[model samples]
Target: MKRRFFCSTLFFITPLLILACNGPSDPGSNFSSGSVTPPLFAHSVKSLLTLSVIEPADPKRATALGQYLVWLVQIDRNGEPFPVNAISIDGGMPAHGHGLPTQPRVTAQVSEGRYRVEGLKFTMPGRWILNFTVSSKLGNDRFSLEIDVGH
Candidate 1:
């Protein structure tokens, strides 16, 4: 009975002894963090489109031409193109002007080499948030890019 108890205690204490002997300190202690940080603008456009622009006036009438311009987005990890999901441009001028479209969503597939976004119009010159949704084999992610066009 004593022999069996000793063997059981030895088995449980062996792993603990080994773990205590191999504490956390390592050779490369200078490294700040384990995970690598991706570039701000390189990996995504969450820092580009933030500024706002006023609507242009129409020739026939003084009515504002409330329309957002289209944008083409491209992502290159190492100078090579890759596929992305969809992009959304919200908040534009002329409160009563044509509202932004809902369906036939802006997709990357429409444009072969680049991701295309329609209805990127600005309502008034101020601050705006441009959100971009990128889908990859790994997963789908959202990024907010700020862009200033006019003053």
Candidate 2:
């Protein structure tokens, strides 16, 4: 009886003991890497803007909007400031949607590597389709991006 009990107890606890002994370890949990990798340019839509998507800074903390989002639309391959006349969300008309700007064209700043669009805000927690029309030296190029912002 004693031998049988001991064997049963050992069999049941063996896996538990092994799991406790081989517990997972957190390697460099407190370390921080300040720099981030740039987004990969998938391709250009027509001749207007180059489209690219980047992974979130931290996948675990990514929201529906995305981790870090930015749009880079450039005109004149020679790399000069292009005038962005109007921008809108979804496919709404400029006057109705009236996105980014309508008048004195806004030029995106090019620095380090990519062109930057500041304060691109997603209002709600859902999928958002952003459409932009940029008129520059080249012409008018329309670009769109679909982003999901989750709560």
lDDT of 1: 0.45
Residue 81 lDDT in candidate 2:
35
What are the lDDT figures for the candidates, one per model?
0.45, 0.45
- lDDT of each residue in 21-125, candidate 2, tens digit only: 666653544546663323333222565455333323442233333223444534334343344445432432233453422221224545422345444554445
**Each prediction's TM-score versus the true structure:** 0.43, 0.42
Model 1 residue 84 distance off true place after TM-score fit, in angstroms: 2.5
lDDT of 1 at 122: 50
lDDT by residue for model 1 over 4-105, one digit each (tens)? 999999999999988777666654556666643222233354432221111122211211234545544555544556555444444322333543343224
Q: What C-alpha RMSD separates each model from the true structure?
A: 19.1, 9.2
